[model samples]
Target: MRILALTSWWPEPANNGSRLRIANLLRALAQKHEVHLVSFRQEAVSAQQIQRMLRICASVDVVPQRVWRPQPGEQIVSLWRSEPASVRATWNPEFAARVGERATDARPDVVVAFQIDTAPYALHVARAPRLLEELEVGNIHAHYVNQTSTHRRLRAWLTWRKHASYVQRLLRHFDACTVVSDNEQQLVRRIAPEMEAIHVLPNGADVHGCARDWGSPEPDTLIYPGALTYDANFDAVKYFISEIFPRVRHVRPGVRFVVTGAAPPELRVALPQAEGVHFTGYVDDVRSLIARSWCEVVPLRQGGGTRLKVLEALALGTPVVSTPKGVEGLDLKQDEHVLIAQTPGEFAAATVRLLEEPELRSRLASAGRQIVAQKYDWSSIGQRLVDLVAALAPHTVVQSKRHLPGQISV
Candidate 1:
C-alpha cells in the first residue's frame, strides 16, 4: 500500500520523543509498504539526513515552514476566526495546499496525520481515506498546561476549549482515529462519538539497541532525560530540585542527579544550586548514561500521552521511580515493573530505597526489560499500525494484499 504521512516538524534529530516515534514507525511501515513523508521543515535538512530518510521512506518532502509571531491585530483576527490556533494557522495554508496537490497526484491508499498539529494539512488531502493519530487527548494537555505553567494561563485555557471543540468536529470527517493509550482512546470517543474506529496504538521503543548489555551502574546516580524546554519537563525538574531532590540528598549525601537533555538557557541557569546535581545540556545518546545510572526518575506534573522517555529507560533495563501521572497510560503495575511515588516525600523515599537495594533495582530493571521486549517494541507497534491502515484502506487498494497478517483489534 502507498501511505502518505503528514507531520508538524522534520522527523529527524530523532532525539526527541515525537520524532523518534515517527521515524521508527515509518521505518517499520516501509518494511511492508511504500511510505511517503510530508513534513514541515523548520530548518533546511542536510543532504546526509535526506539520504538517510530516503533509505527508510519511498519519498520524503520537506516543506519549509517559518515560525510566525503574530501581532495583536492578528491575534484578534485569530480569535475571531476560531478555526485553527494562531500558531497552527500560520503554516496551515501552505502545508494544506502542498498536501492537497500531492494527495491528488499520488492517490495513496491512506493519508495519516501523525498528530493533531498536522490534521489541518491532512484534511486537505482529499484523495485517500484519512486517519488522524491523536497523540494525546489535546484538551487534557492544555488543561494541564493551564494548571502548571505560570506564563500563559489565559492562553492555555483558550487553547483547551479550542482544541476540545476542534477535535470533536475534526474526527467526524476522518475514516479512523488513533491515540497513544486506552485513556486517550476513551477521551477521543467521548469527545467525538461519531468516530467508531479509534485504536489504542501506543508508543514504542528500540528495545534491541537500548537493551544491549552494559557494565555495572555508577553508584548512587539517577538520571531524568527529556527535552527540558517542554513546560512539563521544565516544571518537573524544577519541582524535583526544589522539593524531591533535597529530601533524597538529606538521606543520601553522595547521590548524584543528572539532568540530561536539550534545555533552554534560562532553564539551564535556573537549575538548582544544590550539591551533586549536574545538568548535561544535551547528549547525542542517553542510553549509556541511562545504563550507567542506578535508576531513571520521571517526576512529571503535567503532559499527556505515554512518555517515550520512560519507555526508553525501561527498554534499557533501567528501573524507574515515577509518579502515577508519569506512567499514566502504560498500565504498569506499581512495584512490579516500576516503583510509583506521588508526593515529594514518597519520591525521595523511593529513590533512597532503590539506591540502597541493588537486588530490588535488578528485579525491577529485569521485569521492565522483559515487559517492553514483549509488548512495546517498535516492530509490534508498527505492525499494529500497518494493520490499522490496511483495515481503513479502500477494498480495491487493500484486497490485493489480503494474504497479510490479520488485523489485531484494539
Candidate 2:
C-alpha cells in the first residue's frame, strides 16, 4: 500500500517526542509499504538529515511553513476573529496549495495527518481515505483557561471555545481518527460525540534505545526531563520548587533535583533559587541523565496524552514518582510500576520513600521496564499503525475528480 504521512514536525537530530514518534512510525511503515512523508519544515534541516529520513521513508517532502508571528494590529484583529490564535498562526495558503499538488501526484491509498492542526492540509486531498491523529486534545489551551490568572483566563477561554469548535468540525470530516490513549480517545468522543470512528493508539517508547545503558545509580538525584519551554513542564517545575521541594528537603536535604530540557526565556529567568535545584537548560543525551539519576520525577499537573518521559524512564529501568495526571492513559499501578501522587505533600513524601527504599525502587523500576519492553516499544506500536493503514487501504476509493487539476480534496 502507498501511504502518505503528514505532520508539522519530523525527527531530524532534535530529540523531541512528536518528531521521534513520526520518525519511528514512518520507519516501521516503510518496511511494509511505500511510505512517503509530507511534513511542514519549520526549521532548516540539512541535506544529510533529509537523506537520513529518505533512507527510512520511500520519499520525503517538506512544505516550508513560517510560524506567523502576529503583529500588534493583527493581534487586535485576532481578538474579534472566530479562528483560534494557533489556527491563525499556522494558516498558510501557499503551503496548502503545495500539499494538495503533492497528494494528488502521490495518489496514496491512505493519507494520515499527524495532528488536528495539520488536518487542514491533508483534508484538502478530498478523495483519499484520511486518518486524523490527535496526539492530544489541545489540553494546553484548556489548561490555560482553567488555571491561569483572571485576565489571561478570559482570553484563553475565548481561544479554547473557538479552537474546540474548529477541531470538532475538522474531526467530523476524517474517515477515521486516532488518539494517543484511551483517556484521550474518551475526551475526543466527549467533544465530538457523533464521530463514530475515533480510536486509541497509545504513545510508545523506543525501548531498545532507552534500555541500552540501563544501570543503577549511586546517589539520590531526581531528574525531570522534557521541553522546559512547554507550560506544563514549567508549571511542573514551579510546583515542585514552591511546594514539593521544601517538604522533601526536610526529609532528604542532600538530594538534588536536576531539571533537564530546552528552557524558554521566561522559564530560564524564573529558575528556582533553592540550594538543591539544578536547572540544566538542555542536554545532548537525556538517557545519560536518567541513567545517572536515582529516580525520575514527572510533576505535570495540566497536560493531555501519555508522557514520553515516563516511558523513557521506565524503559531505562529508573523508578518514577509522578502525579496521577502524569501517568494518565497508561495501565500503571501506584507503588508498582510507578508511584503516583496528587498533592505536593504527597509527591514529596513519595519521592522521599522511593529515595530511601532501594529494594522497592529496584522492584518498581524492573516492573516498569518489563511493561515498556512488552507493550510500549515502537516496533510493536508502529506495526499496529502499519496494519491500520493496510486494512483501511482496501476500502479506499480513488475519486475520478482526484486526478482533475485545480480540484482540491482531503
Candidate 3:
C-alpha cells in the first residue's frame, strides 16, 4: 500500500513530542507500505535530518512554510477573511499543489494529515481514506477568554468563533481522526458533534530505548524536558519559577531545577532569573537529561492532550510531581503513578518529599515505569495508528495474517 503522510513541518530528528509522534507513525507505516512524505520546512532541516527521514520515507518533499503576518492596518482585512490568522498563514498553495500532484501520480491508499493546519491539504486527496492525525484543537480553546481586557476578550471570542467554525468544516471532510487524549477527543466532538470515527491515539515514548537503566537520578535535582519555544512550555517554566520553584527552593536551598530544550534568548529574558534554575537550550538527546534527574516536575497550567514529557519520564524510571492538569488525560493514579499537587504550595511540598524520601521516589518511579510499559510505549501506540489506518482502508489488507508486529490483522 502507498500512504501519503502530510505534515505542517518536516518531522525529522524528532526532538519534540509532536515530531516524535509523526516520525514513529510514519516509520510504522513504512515497515509494510510505501510512505511518501510532503511537508513544509519551518526551519533549516539539516542533511542529517533528511537522512533520518530517508531511513523511513520512500520519498520526501519539503517546501518553505507559508510566511504570513498581519501587516500594519490589516486588522480589517483579517476580520474580513472570517478565519483566524493561524489558518490564513498556513494555507500554502505550493504545498496544496504538491500534495495534489503527488496524489494524482501515487494514488495513495491512505492520506494522513498531522494537524488541523494540514487537514485542508488532505481533503484535496479526493479518493483516499483520509486520517486526520493528532488534530488536537483544545489548545485554541484554552486561551485568552479569561483575560480582563475587553479588547483581548473580544479578539479571543472572534478568534475562537472563526477557528472553531473552520475546523468543524474541515472535520467533516476526513474519513477518520485521531487525538492524543480523551480530552482532545471531546474537544473535537464539541466542535463537530455529528462526526464519528475519532480515535484516541495517545502520546508515547521510545520505551525500547528505556530498556537499559537510564542511570541513577541525580539527587537534589528536578527536570522538565520541554522546549521554551512553545507558549505552554514557556508558561509552565515561568509558573514553576515564579510560584512553585521558589517554594521548593525555600524548603531545600540546595535543590536544583533543570529545564532542557531550546530556549530562545528573547523568551529566556522573561523567565525569572534564579540561583538554582538552569536551562539547557536544545538537547540532541533529552532522555539522558531526564533519566539523571531526581524528579520530573510538570507544573503545566496550560495546554491540552496527554504530555509526552510525563510518559518519557515514567519510561525512564524518573518519578514525577505534576499538577492534575499536567496529567489530565493520562491513565495515571495519584500517589500511585505520580504525586499530584494542585497549588504552588502543594507542588513544592510534593517535590520536596520526592527528593527527601528515597523510598517514595523508588515506589513512584517503579509504578510510573510499569504504567508506561503497558500503555504509552511508542511501538504499541504506533501500531494503534496502523490499526486505525488499516480499519479505514480495509481493502488494502489481503490476508488474515499480520505483516508487522502488533498489526490488527486487518
Top-scoring candidate (lDDT): 3
lDDT of 2 by residue, 1-410 (tens): 66778887856655777777777777777777666677777677777777777665656677676677766666557777877666878787876876677777777888888877688888788677888875467485556657658888776676666666777888777788888888677767877888888767777888878757546575879999977778888889888888998898898889899988787777767866788888787777778888778889999888777788899889888899999889988888888899999988889999999999989888998999999988899899888887677667777542221211222222
lDDT of 3: 0.83
Ranked by lDDT, the better of candidates 2 and 3 is 3
Tell me each candidate's TM-score: 0.90, 0.89, 0.92
User: Model 3 reaches what TM-score against the true structure?
Assistant: 0.92
List the candidate 2 regions with Cα displacement exceeding 4 Å: 70-82, 138-141, 144-157, 214-216, 264-266, 395-410
Q: Write the per-residue lDDT of candidate 1 for residues 271-388, one digit (tens) a residue.
A: 7778888888788887899988998999987888888988888998889999987998896888889999989999999999999998999899899988898889988999998888
lDDT per residue for candidate 3 within 1-410, as digits (tens), equals 77888987578667877778877788778776777788887788776777667667666777788777767766556777866766776588888988998788778889999977788889889878898998877776877555578988887777777788888888788888998888888888998998888899898888888768667667898999888988889999999999998888888999999999989899999899999989888888888888999899999988877888899899988999999989988999999999999998999999999988999988998998899999998888888887788888888853332232221100
TM-score of 2: 0.89
Question: Which whole-number lDDT from 0 to 100 does residue 357 have in model 1?
Answer: 91
As for candidate 1, its clashing pairs are none
**All candidates' lDDT scores?**
0.80, 0.78, 0.83
Candidate 1, after superposition: displacement of residue 262 in Å? 1.5
- Candidate with maximal TM-score: 3
Runs of candidate 3 with Cα error greater than 4 angstroms are 72-76, 148-151, 397-410
